[model samples]
Target: MTTSLRSTLDFLLYDWLQAESVTSRERFVDHSRDTFDAVLDICERIAREKYAPFNRTVDTQEPHFDGEKVTLPQCTHDAQKAYAASGMLSAAQDYDIGGMQLPYTVEAAANSFFAAASVSIGSGLLTVGNANLLMVHGTELQKKVFALNEFSGRFSGTMCLSEPQAGSSLSDVATRAVPDGEGFEADPLGPRYRLKGNKMWISAGEHELTDNIIHLVLAKIPGPDGKLVPGTKGISLFIVPKKLVDTEGNLTGVRNDVALAGLNHKLGWRGTTNTLLNFGEGKYPVGGEAGAVGYLVGQPGKGLHCMFHMMNEARIGVGMAATMLGLAGYYASLDYARNRPQGRPVQGPKAAAGAAPAVVKDAAQPQVRIIEHADVKRMLLAQKAYGEGALALNLYCARLVDEMHTGEAALADDARMLLEVLTPIAKSWPSEWCLEANSLAIQIHGGYGYTRDFPVEQYWRDNRLNMIHEGTHGIQAMDLLGRKVLMEGGRGLTLLASRINATIERAIQVPALAAHANALGAALQQVGAATKAAWATGQPADALANAVPYMQAFGHTVLAWIWLDVASAALASDADQAQPSTAGRMGAMRYFFHYELPKIGAWLQVVSSRDDTCAAFPEESF
Candidate 1:
């Protein structure tokens, strides 16, 4: 079996995780290095032995539904079952739920392996994690009804946010929830109102893999005045089940009210089910013998807020998954490069004195590995920067999660605020950049990358879904610039800037990193200036128009900070390693600063401009 490139990246991440524990002094609830490594080892073994071997087969023999039942490749089912039985599905949950309850950071690291192995198969596990999150925040009765079933792997869960009309705009969602006759006693805890609507693009919405599916749906509840409550204020979250539950909280059978209308054949991630669902199909009795059964989560008007809880977690998952896919492609390309011999350098002279030049077929000597080429190295470096950098960023956030939960209260507050500010970037930037890495991996493979014969192409397809997953790049941009940065009088943004400045101050003292430190400081100031000017205008839309540039600016700035931290830590470690490798460490640091850090200047320029090119175009231009 070929060793995974992702595993090597995870090894690096494991080192970072340990460093974070020492530096942050926060013990993670779910994972430590030992536990994380063991899980990753298991994932690596399973991914190589079980999943990777079947990836192409699963892709060719995609899941199929014949009117009544859906059938997937046996290998796909086996892989899914093996992953579930390994207790990986509950990584983010507490141990009481039959889970290892690994830390999100550790789980994120492990997921990289699975996604790299087979993105489509890996998605099933992600949906399970998503369901578990909702169950944690859900009511006790809801837990008994939904969470318990999920724990048993009897019911898979999906987040249903998009509609045919409301893509990213939740406020525009037209799905309606009406009060029924005292609600239905599907579970003894309490009855719930009937939910009737059409939800589109629901992942795992209607699949035969599990006995039931729990959909966390968003819909508008009627107010006392009868009109839709203003905007999202009228919106509420509901737990809509594919089958009605008994008073004993047992899923009896399929309920006709919720029917699978159609399946969406997507560009990629094909092993997972995506369905168009029609509620209130009028075929079976629902809540109080009415329409579809729906239970309210959190509060009536606070549905959108509740959804954000899951959305944030999902966003990080998206980033991690995308990064993993790219890492997989990178590893495959690297392996192929190292082993595949092609033409020699054109600059080299022919072999001397009757020796044959390196050539193919019956006439020649052995050729050099493709990896020796400079262009191949360039692609590898780009992949490393994006994939490894994203890994560092996500793991850093996970460490913050630990700090938020276990550190001193004051420190926890600061960590939480800083994490909140970085969340969008942590989620969106990697999805964008690592997908680029996947694309580069394909390029490295040349023509083979375009065919199923090479996994890099599949990696590209899988990563493409990430652009629309959790949230789109545009949505994330708006959230970062319009809300998180400006929220609470820029408290989050200030906290983040303070942290970056602290690193900048430290790097400034190091001769090797001093210049990049100065550049990052200047970039931070430019970002602050741009932010202030946007806010000063008091036009949120204009501020949002510049959101994409702001994301790029802030992403690079934070990445520089992270790179500096890593370089400093590496240099310090080299000094302590007895047999010092300070020179090599210094070279890597210099390469990053001189070659990578300068890009921040260009990013800052665009951000500071506050250009309204997006707004300048009229709606009719197209």
Candidate 2:
């Protein structure tokens, strides 16, 4: 494993999880630093060996639809099988259910390796998130039938929410789930319904990598009038399997009514199959019906709430994916900078006034490695700040999830609240900033970074999809300022502030960190003030018009808090003096506090002023 990767995981397990008692709970009894390190090592080894080798191949030879079946590189299946056999597919599940029962924090850290190595083959992420949703909301039978298969890797899963027309606006979901009258009672999942709709942008939607594909679809169930309800209130979730399964979770070798309309060629993440799917189009009916049979997973009219369970998990997963890609790019660029010798010191005596002062031998005045140049170092440092800091923020969120799952009730409740508020920032910040880091990685690589020969370009391409994966930047921004901050009378925001302030107070005890702590405190206050000012205008349009800016400022402030925590951890480590990693942490912290923190002020200005510059402009003007 890379030093950066191991250090970050250590920081999570030791500096954060144990420190916060996230792994001290009864449920996480077997979790220790050794076990966590072991899991990370396995993930890193498998990721490097299996997934990394086929990353480029998967991207270039994306799933091909041959009118009869979809074909993928054999390596995709090989890599997936390796992952499933490693037991990470069920790493965080219960022991009775064949899980390793690792803490979510460790599981998240382990997953980052796969994301960094080959996000293309990271289809398991969705499957796990889907299984988690079923574990939370599905009945015992549903768990046995679908979730277990998914966790075992026999059946991969996907969250089927977006449609060809509805996109992220689930209220506009037009998919209908009519009750399967006579034969519905035989189904074990629940009262079965015939789902008839088309879903779009479904990743891993259809693949031959697994034996079966389970889709957790959101659709509307009709009321007494036999007419579909108009909004999300009518939405409900369903377990729609690609192949018919018996009550005992055995595949019956019968294809369901689901059909792949086609594959949507994407600009990025081409490694994973993105599909347009037609359900109940009558291509193959399970029980002489034109609609696909689906078993209800949750109550009708509560589908959005049920899906949010998966969406939120996937959102954090997306953030981690983004962060890993940024880190991957950073390491790649750093290696390139060190080896690809170029330009000399900008102030190398100006060539002695063009007198061609003795050409120093290559051995003496050898061209300095790009890393030795100030500008290249600046970009590299920026990437380190963004990549590592975003990573810390992600693991921190994962630790919060651990607390929510295992800590005391009150502490768990507080963790939930903070996660609710932080989720949007956690998702959006990395999707935005880490992509920026990838861009810097490319710049650090100069012209070669733009070429297909380098992995940095692919990293950028893969990461570009995350911005719109779980949600768009604008949507997350709206959620952050328009909802999360103000929810429960601002409890989440308050809790988050208290936590950051606690870190600030602790930092003040150390002279080296006091200045950064003060800067963060000021930034935190700016966010609070902006939060108040933005919402003061009762007009939601006015308040939300500058949501993007609010998210930017708020996200930066959150990163500042995370960086401070990281710096404190580095300082407190048992190293006799400042090790290179400690120095690197301090340097990154200084970069963020000096360069990135101040930009938040400009963003806050836009938010606090309730700037209508864009929102007030007429749509026709576009």
Candidate 3:
């Protein structure tokens, strides 16, 4: 069975947010469930028809480099073109910019469909994120010349932060951007510069899919003495297009100095190109210069600051992508379980004491479907919990983005703090847990899951990349414990606690959820204690030694709170009817609390004790 992005989105938009009256006022005016459903329906149709069919083809053929040009499946272009024309690219932007002005929550839901259908074709995510960053920080000319074209799909965008030498350590970025004297254009897109550097691991970096590629490159501006400054403090953002364009959004037909050096082959997500690009190798010099022409974005020496907006957005997008992949695998496995007959009840009549009953193609006593087994049911339930729970977490974070944009001062501040605290978990939890859900998906398919015949293996392969997407698991953990949770004098953590407490309080009002609520309450207390103990160690190294465990414990508590809220919402919708769907939700809620919440205690114990087993171990000892 195909995954119903529509049904899930409808429930989330109408049953949860509409019931909560979250997006009733402000920029969301004239937006109703019908409108949201209409947009999602379009996304579903396009994704199913254009994208899903070619997923495996893209994975198999991948992108080929013929030395001079990169070749991709025509289907990839068709899918992306369809997506671009859907108008969903600017779905969350203001109407003034040819956008739908839809709430971020609705937009995110619509995008989830595409991500689930084919993450390979879902390369538009980076373009959207890049345009969003420019919309926020780009000059008016930059918005018109670059961001607008991106919104209209005439141009594509990429974020260039990683270099061959720098890797994730942005502080060591060695790219240099020098002020252009003769090559400067007196156009509106911003100040012109000459970028001379090489960028590596640039996805969607060099593509023939669009007229031009707008690169939001991070490079350091040289000092007055022509010496390159060190570290990210000297880093600045630049709009270095693949082909230089005129102010009227027309390509000047002057090819920039950005050259596609080579392609990086990967295990998955191969539909999009990953490239090593040389900026100024004296290859394609423009205007009698040997450097790539670029325009400064925002301010010089503050590139990382502006890039964070895009990075954070990309982090959340990664979580959503992970959740959708898990959900897709879950549905596929579920269909397999319901039809793939494998075994009979272990205790049912003992197979009539026969020697395996001479297994035949069509035996009189046909085996029952695998889903009938308790263990298989447990796996399904586990997938359901992780998949749906991760979806809820992602949508919640998206809603917070909406609130931060549209809410009142105090409410917006609260939303920002809560989002900040949850960002790491939002990015990391789903990447870890949902990938585990995908593993269960493979296991559900048994032997066939390991083969190319099944999609489950591909799902697992695609999801494995997310654990390292944006940031690795360890990086997110450190950020959560060492930075975000402790920032602003712990106001973010305090705000998050209050919100979780609100959910717990609401859950306590429902007798069905009271026990889970109490469990969550106790777990929250342990998290609080763990937080204090981890910090009280005084030794930053020791306190952070078990940061990953701290992240897990904290992540579980957050998910527990989310489940409680979800259970409350489900029950709320069927308070008197006691529908089966509601009952199923309650069952999953119980499963999570019973099976998942208890694991947090041991994790938190290790965290709170400030264990330094890994930190103290000598690398040579290994």
Candidate 4:
């Protein structure tokens, strides 16, 4: 599994994305191919030794809270510490803060190993994202007290969003953050406040992996009338620590007013703790108060905007996690198909004159490997197409992150626009398709797939959570069709089309890729037309009615373009050295184009016509 993944990473990083070229930029000048390889080597080794061996251990053992503290397996603690020691928590940060200043592209690829090894064991996505958000919007002192410690792994972080009542509807959040005291504005760590609310489904919400858990909470600050403001615009980000910390980053030796309400027993990702947490419930009040003390991150009422910095990063991370799980399933199933021989091939009645024979074999022959069967091959290919294609898409988004930060003016502008257009697709497409890959993997495992004895069923369960978290498929669809495509008056979508067309132009020059190039070109056209048609009446209600289908069609078109781009690159890849992996990619690309691309048309039909069958149906009928 590691070998296959390593080879794929090599091809994606060097051959396709040209990660080495980023070294030309001043931010990454200290790095090179050697430094990147060293990091990758460390991550892959740690993942294999510390994570892969313990995948089942953590899953079966799970995390248990015994009222006082959460008890995780010893192996989980070992893995978490090892990950923190890896410097990956700050791999993309500056050199001054104990970072390698590596490009996000390399960082993302390096992290995939750990995710594939065990998706359940935490990998610092929330911590890194939390710190990164602070670096962008935090004050100098706040950065020192909070973000820096998070990057150093002395502290872990989580974003507290969905409340039990609000769930996905931020506008309905009831969490309130009022000024802590009269001198709150004078405090060094930004404005201080006392928060009272309950957050639900918080991952890594309660853990002993780090010295402190800095929760970036979202809450509403009341207006002058002492009434909590409504909607997301009123939402604000806060830094609520599990334990209070002073200016010098020393532990204040006092627990915050935060209390763990209960643990959520999830179907998957059990290694990480999910909790219902209560703030300001008088559990452990500070200074005789009944509220959780928190420091403001940005301006009040702009909390969602600030939290979005972390949320967007998390969305991409979620996409990568989904891709790795799908790949893990694919690898497990592939191994089973190769060695577990099944029934012999059934021969045809007879071949017609001058016609090809379907099979030239006898029933009395030895049973062949399941891989020899075309149906199994089809399932394997679909998994490959979905998993690898999703990986490439996520990595491409990461590459854009590098460009957005380091490229020249015009290039950075283009990268920024393209990223906005692709983020939803990047998050949702893998979550939707790669899940199917897991299902196919289970199907290939036959009866064993259903039982817990095999890992494939676990992979499916683990992946099932991806679509619902980070933003559900429905949310992403609305964001894409209702907002992303129409963002900046469709400027982002236009930038995306330009990039896709450039790939089409390049792939069309190659004989073997021309057909796919044409198909993708048509797909791009269909999606563009559907985007316009959906909103032709300029009524958001009608336009977003079939948003999920539009998103599905758009995501498929984007993926088709990605596969074509990869296949075009594979043409120039080393013919002998990369023959096997390269051939596999080529086959996967073909599978995507042949079997997956056409399905977009049916999905797009609803979008183009603004079909209202589902939306128009009365809820009472159900």
Q: Which candidate is the best by TM-score?
A: 4
In model 2, the number of clashes is 0
Instruction: Return the TM-score for each candidate structure.
Output: 0.89, 0.96, 0.95, 0.98
What would the per-residue lDDT of candidate 4 be over residues 1-622, giving only the tens digit for each residue? 9999998999999999999999988998888999999999999999999999989988899788889789999999899899999999999988988888999999999999999999999699999999999999999998999999999889999999999888899899899999988999998988999999999999999988899999999999999999987677889889999999999889989999999999999899989999999999998979998999999987888889998898899999999999999999999999999999888887876889999878666868999999999999999999999999999999999999999999999999899989988999999999999899999999999999999889999888899999999899999999998888888899999998998999999888887889999999999999988888999999999999998998889999999999989887888785443677778888999999999999999999988888889989999999
Worst 10 residues of 1 by lDDT: 22-31
- Write candidate 2's Cα lDDT for 424-448 as tens digits: 9889999999999999999999999
Q: What lDDT does each candidate get?
A: 0.73, 0.88, 0.87, 0.92
Candidate 3, residues 477-531, lDDT tens digits: the string is 9899999989999999899888889998888988888999999999999999998
Q: So what's the TM-score on candidate 2?
A: 0.96
TM-score rank order: 4, 2, 3, 1
Clashing pairs in 2: none
lDDT of 1 by residue, 535-563 (tens): 76687776777777678778877777777
Q: After superposition, how far is residue 219 of candidate 3 from its true place, in Å?
A: 0.8
Regarding lDDT, does 1 or 3 come out ahead? 3
**Model 4 ranges off by over 4 Å:** 349-362, 575-578
